[model samples]
Target: MEVLQMEVLQMMTPIEFWRAGFVFWTRAAEAQLEFASRWICAVGLSQRAAQTAAQKATIEALRAASVVPLAPNAISTPVPKRAARKAPRLAASRCRPTAH
Candidate 1:
């Protein structure tokens, strides 16, 4: 079982590993947000204040997990527009008319 698990892990690409890390930290951040919300609400904080506090706590957790929040003007390059998708070509047999 351990060898199987190791083999599976070894098969994971770098992007897959990064995605796994991202999902793990995203959940952790969400849990932090919930905790902050409950704590602030228990303290009789205003709704807006509670939200702000929760957001800050979530950001801190994300930062600790190495997920850096980017500013609006932090992007160095303009994002390129996605190219239009092309329809798949039909197989010759499928395209041909069948005899009745």
Candidate 2:
């Protein structure tokens, strides 16, 4: 458990954790489906409930990751400006910024 926690902490960003969580849930859902189809007796839980529980767990993990501290002064790239006018972009040469 300690090792798992360490590994999860070592991950760079929340997005990476979210992506891994997605993969984990995908594999888990597949495994659950396989098990349900092969087993004759019910596992005392409905298939829908099992899937919902798995999804809930994954979402909780994501939420926890979202709150973890990141760089105090993180800088993000600014979004590019969108054309406001309906005129053709090619014809609107004046609208474009002058290249230095």
Candidate 3:
């Protein structure tokens, strides 16, 4: 058991460990949400209605889980404007056609 633990620790960096754990938890949460949605539908709710309810439930779940939903004004940084450059012109006499 100790040997196995050491091997596992050696296999992943801290970032990788956290990323893997996050992915696992996210997927588990999503599965739970899907199950809840399916259950709602099974309880005689119309498919479209169930889907709408599920979407609201998902938003609430994500908010409770501390996952911030994207909004229109979410960008914190202003985009930098690029300096315009003149396009290079090639001499027609120097241009050569290659046979494909």
Q: Assess each prediction's global lDDT (C-alpha) against the native.
A: 0.84, 0.57, 0.73
The digit string of per-residue lDDT tens for model 1 on 15-78 reads 9988888999999899889888999999999989999989877776776787667653334458
- Residue 96 of candidate 3: its Cα lDDT? 86
TM-score for predicted model 2 compared with the true structure: 0.33
Colliding residue pairs in candidate 3: none
User: lDDT, candidate 1, residue 12?
Assistant: 100
Q: Which stretches of candidate 1 lie over 4 Å from their true place?
A: 69-100
Which number leads on TM-score? 1
| lDDT tens digits, residue span 6-91, model 3 | 89978999998777766765776688779878999889899888887776666665555654554433343466789999998779
TM-score for predicted model 1 compared with the true structure: 0.63
> What TM-score would you give candidate 3 relative to the actual structure?
0.46
Candidate 2 backbone collisions, by pair:
none
Candidates in order, TM-scores: namely 0.63, 0.33, 0.46
Runs in model 3 deviating more than 4 A are: 56-100
What lDDT does candidate 3 reach at residue 83?
90
Measured on C-alpha atoms, candidate 1 has an lDDT of 0.84
